[model samples]
Target: MTGTILTEDAGDGVRIVTLNRPHRLNAIVPELLDDLNHALEAADRDPAIRAIVLTGAGRAFCSGDDLKDFGTQAADEPGTRAYIERIQDVTRNLVLGDTPIIGAIRGWAVGGGLEWVINCDFAIAAEGTRFFFPEIAWGVFVTGGVSELLPRLVGLQRARELIMLGERFDAAQAREWGLVYKVVPDATLRDEALNLARRIAALPVGPVRDLRRILARRDALAPAMAAETDATVRGFLDPATAARIGAFK
Candidate 1:
């Protein structure tokens, strides 16, 4: 699959989805969201695609949502709710779909970018990579389900520090926090992710999917619910949020 937002291919029963907006650090835009949903659906439908790898071009995995486009007329127009809904749908699919997703991250994964990584079934980061959730600083809360995912990955207190303070964590720190499955040298990030994907692909699909579903159910009940609620409250009060709201109005 090829689109303005992404490129994809299937090999050895694994699908690799590459975010193509290098200049923008693979920031989420409406078009990108659409393309990503389509690509994910395609991978889920293909029996040959037992695993999926999501990565970005250039240095950064993803910087977050494209702020320039976020509150623009196009994004806030009457039918814009559909686009937002589509983003949520895509993320839900990623979490619930049977094909395990491995995030191959390098450089920065911030805000919605980090949300993307959190939603993946597994993640591996380059040694020098940085992860952060700066949505609070930007005057918004997470829209990509980070509130539900972060605490499960890093626990409550750590999640608060990251989201509330909008602090950045290095690859090593992320691994220690249990956010990343592994940290490799920058040069080996892609290779490591691919190797992990291959390992997952080699597993029996039924069992693998069952494992994911079980984990998701377990995580969704307590910590995930609390964090999500807190995030929703904080997002509207974020400092950088006014500009976007103003633009939308």
Candidate 2:
């Protein structure tokens, strides 16, 4: 367990990784991302840990990036690239890593938060959980391999509408759109997620891990993640992005 990321052994080879910035609605900041990457790496390397439930500490799973602090990280090109890369690394660890991660999504999962939701092996959203990508409106590009994953999850047309329009969708709609594996009562979200993880952990680890690896197809993601990084960095460095994000603030 760390200040920004909390790790709890849920027994039965399941680990619960909770985003710990509840006061900020678990908003993304550099420190939080760094801690999250390290925590995820540790869990993945541990042989005893068979499944992980990824969630947030408070009202929202993640309210996306801390807008007030976002501009400074992207003040220059190199800085922008590095910051975006760090964000992408979380997705890499979640999707390409050996351990399976199930998202216990609650409340708002906006922008990059939504990207991480998509990155999960599968997600279980709580009732009333809201999701959307506001990057386009803010003149920034979507990251976390959403370009490659979302189109495949939903159809190309639906992906375009969600990304381009930046409209919010509820948990029920997300399930209908195939974004979430299931939706549970908000009260039992974490318990349900942990139960699901326990079920996965009880399975033969070798076959389960093999299935995750085969299905993840790490080889195909290199180009997609690279393209996402390049595009997102460019968006962050754009003058229009500064104006748009500034106005939002």
Candidate 3:
């Protein structure tokens, strides 16, 4: 399938979904979300596609939500809220899809970008790639399922540190923290990721899909609970405690 936000192709039972918005760091916009959902649904429906790889063009994998698209508007309000919900749904579909996803992260994966990585079944990052969740500093909370996914991947305390401090982690640090499965040199990242995808694609479909479903179901609940906790804390913070505290003079 071809679209502005995504480019997709199937080969040897592997469907590779490339995030196409290099200018925006492949940030999640409405159209991008729609296209991604469509690509994923197509892969899930296709009997031949046994594995999926999600990657971005240009230097960065994804920088986060399209702040340019959202502009300066607050996301908690009704109009923006609906948009956020749709974005979340897109994320949910990616995680819950039958075909397991492997993220080939090259450069920066921040905010919503990190959420995308967290949702994936496996992630491989380039050695110098950076990861962070900066929404707390933006006077908002993570709407892309980070709260739920982070803890499960890296444990509670590490997730809290990343979210609360908005600290950035390098690829090596991320691997140490259990966020990424492997980290390779920048030049070999894509080849490594593709090789991994091919390996997964060669597996038997019945056992592969069953194993994916078992893990996905268990993994799904953590994000949901994390979303609830994040919403509760975010609601109490309103404009956000971190942002408000910074205004003190």
Which candidate should be chosen as best, given lDDT against the real structure? 2
TM-score of every model versus the real structure: 0.86, 0.97, 0.85
**Top candidate when judged by TM-score against the true structure:** 2
lDDT of 1 by residue, 92-160 (tens): 778878889999999989877888788888899999898888776666666566666777777889878
**Model 2 error, position 238 (Å):** 0.7
lDDT tens per residue, model 3, 156-248 = 998889998999889999889888899999899878877898899898877877886776665666557456544634542475543453454
- Once superposed on the true structure, which residue ranges of model 2 sit more than 4 Å away at CA? none
Record all residue pairs in model 3 with backbone atoms less than 3 Å apart, i.e. clashing. 148-223
> Which scores better on TM-score, 2 or 3?
2
**Candidate 1 clash pair list:** 139-238, 139-241, 140-235, 141-235
- Clashes (backbone N, CA, C under 3 Å), per candidate, total 4, 0, 1
* lDDT assessment of candidate 3: 0.76
Residue 214 in candidate 2 has what lDDT? 84
TM-score-superior candidate, 1 or 2:
2
How far out, in Å, is residue 156 in model 2?
0.4
Model 1 accuracy (lDDT, Cα): 0.76
